[model samples]
Target: MSDSNTTDFTNPSTFILLGIPGLEAAHAWLSIPYSIVYAMAILGNFTILFIVKMEPSLHEPMYYFLCMLAATDLVLSTCILPKMLAIFWFRSREINFDACLIQMYFTHCFSAMETGILVAMALDRYVAICHPLRYSTILTNPVVAKIGLVVVLRGIILFFPYPFMARWRPYCSTNIIAHTYCEHMAVVKLACSDTRLSNYYGLFVILFVASVDLAFIAVTYTQILRTIFRLPTKDARLKTFGTCGSHLCVISCSYIPSLFSFLAHRFGQNVPLYFHILIATVYLLLPPMLNPIIYGVRTKQIWETLLRLFPPKGG
Candidate 1:
């Protein structure tokens, strides 16, 4: 092929995100519903953060971990949605290389941090249920602060290599990203260079962080269940397990879709491209939308407080 027919691998600049292919005519209409969902996610998470911060009774370790999770959700949703909305609303899909890398960094970093926070929340529940006497001692304010700091640092350090890896690649291929946002694998696949190292690092990070955290959470819940089952009273068991319902719902919402999207992306060649992309978008968007709602509905304290703060009009 002639030089004019080939792309410049060393100096390509911009990437175009084709949002929800085969639906170009409906992009404007789709933006309305997506914008509503995005608004709910921001409002719900911010409300959770505000309630946890302003309510003195919610100064305990569990609420502290919840505040962290809420903040992570806020950042994650904000990172993915604004650009997506711009694409849907105004048909603006062009993203600069540097800008895409920044988005990639925050996307992975906050995701890992959210997983870390979930693990910390599980630990708090384990201590509360399995070792009630030691709960306060184990998860003190200083300890909670340390856990938050570690979660933030781990995310930043582990995912910092993502952008650098993408930057090192020579992208002579097409720059149109198939998804709505800049994901690690999506961006890596656009490169002209060998991406084995980058791909491996990405996989290792996911397995090391998310997989391990999920495993640990499982073990903690197992211990919690054993302890609850051993309780003398049925009401005690019901009450103890009730405390976990919200976390269970949040965990299920966060991990199940994400795991499915990852598996489908890597292995399910028979699946339609739009299905994979849609599931991936849902994996990112749904957790932020559902978590606060789960917590609000399942946790009696937060629900009661919310009602008290904003009473019904007829009441």
Candidate 2:
């Protein structure tokens, strides 16, 4: 905890992660639910990917975006959960510094990718609902491919600096991070150097991405609602609105906890440290776990496909 002037300013060989600080005694019990959720996330997302890939009928723009989302969720959760489980169940808390940086990069990169995909999905729904006649021509296969590439490239470009920024800082203080994984800000905060630049850049990225993406979603949904209200029959309006329910649910699942965790980290001065850690953990776990379920339950096509793929024993 010494200042840089007094302490030798050398990065430690390894950083120790104290999983969910102050909850060490319950780490074993905590691992149970964490393990279950991780398993479910893996299983659910993989199923979505498999079904989408195998079903010729699903080779459309919307399902393609869902596949991207499932893949992003897989990477996002995998980047942290295994190490987290190690910390909780086996007391394996030491992480190589370089490896930690890699984990941080992938975690944030895919998170941003997920956000981008949600926006793309909003656009898809907007077109499907608001411009039903042109939906096919507007979201052609090549256009969908380009959108996917843009989403990937946007995340890679924006978050690519995070690890390098963290690496350049001099971590002369203690090498123990009070979280399960190498979160970008958590790692950067360990540095002894002035971190205002890193802090401001992080804030800027969050606000820029969130504000622009949310604004796009808001505009698209506004148009979609207007189009739906103009429909002639009540059933048509209900059916059209139903098409967006799953995306809306997934967006809520992904953004609400994420926004809460980010705000809690930055401004929740009176919030307990453990609560912040727990919310951060849930923010990562909940969306991946719920996205597939939301889609499968709400989308008749996916639900029917699942039923067809796994017929009842009596039938």
Candidate 3:
């Protein structure tokens, strides 16, 4: 471990990440599970992108949004997993200051992007279910492209201040980060100066993004459910609801852990440090690993495409 007393306290060249406080001895064992999750996330999301690209029938709005989701998952997981595994497996815990900022930006930016994509997906379902005759016209290829652009731009613009915020602060305190990655709060907390502005800004971003995006998603799904129930046949209703099953599962996976981590960091004073770190780390990884599996199993088209691409033998 680098000695804080000897190093320049104002601006250390590199910040030392502790991986997970209170679990240093178990780092090697913990790396195994995290590595597995990262591998699965990589494979699953890439497969989703590949299948959606190669299959002509999946070139519609829903699948296109799915591709966006997969890509976002890829960015979100990749932003942290490799560095985290390095910290755990090889004891490579030193991260350059600018690099840390970069990681923090991508981590939060893609998280916001994921939320926006989920909203777009909910809207897609709404149009498809409530107005089947006008679904195609409502979500045209151009509109979908525009929506994708907006999601990407929204994240980029919203998070562009994160790096600057962290960079402007003078880190005269210790250079050790208790978390695996350079999280926004963790980095800003190291600053010697007042961090109330940074802290409140972080809270504002979280509330603004989560509240607006989740509210839109809630309203969209409410309309969708109302439409589904209006159908006369039980079979029609069941099938219509079935299409949203995978999305609902994905939404739960994405938001629940995320909300818990966010709230716990702010309010869970009694929670152990390692527990908070573990939840935050898993929050970054678990959804990417689960999302592809959920869609593959629950969506008929994706499942059939997967089987066709890699069929079982001994027929």
Q: What is the lDDT of residue 241 in candidate 1?
A: 97
Q: Which wins on TM-score, candidate 1 or candidate 2?
A: 2
Give stretches of model 1 more than 4 Å off.
1-6
Cα error of candidate 3 at position 154, Å: 0.9
Model 2, position 55: C-alpha lDDT score: 83
Compared with the true structure, what per-residue lDDT tens digits does model 3 show for residues 1-315? 866634556767888898999999999999999989999999999999999998999999999999999999999999999999999889999999889999999999999999999999999999989999999999999999999999999999989999998998888758888899999999998898999989888889989999999999999998998998899999999999998999999999999998999889889999999999999988889999999999999999999998998899963
Per-model CA lDDT versus the true structure: 0.89, 0.91, 0.92
Worst 10 contiguous positions by lDDT, candidate 1: 2-11
Backbone collisions counted per model: 0, 0, 0
- Tens-place lDDT digits, model 2, residues 93-138: 9999999999999988898999999999999999888787999999
TM-score of each: 0.95, 0.96, 0.97
Better by lDDT, candidate 2 or 1:
2
Q: What residue pairs are clashing in model 3?
A: none
RMSD vs true structure, all candidates: 2.0, 2.3, 1.5
TM-score of 2: 0.96
Q: Give me the candidate number with maximum TM-score.
A: 3
Residues 1-315, candidate 1: write the lDDT tens digits: 645324566755778889888777887887887888789999999999888877889889999899899889999999989999999888899999899999999999999998899999999999999999998888999999999999999999999999999998887857788888899999999888889999899999988997789899999999999999999999999999999989999999989999998899789999988788779878888888899999999998899888888799998
lDDT of 1: 0.89
lDDT of 3: 0.92
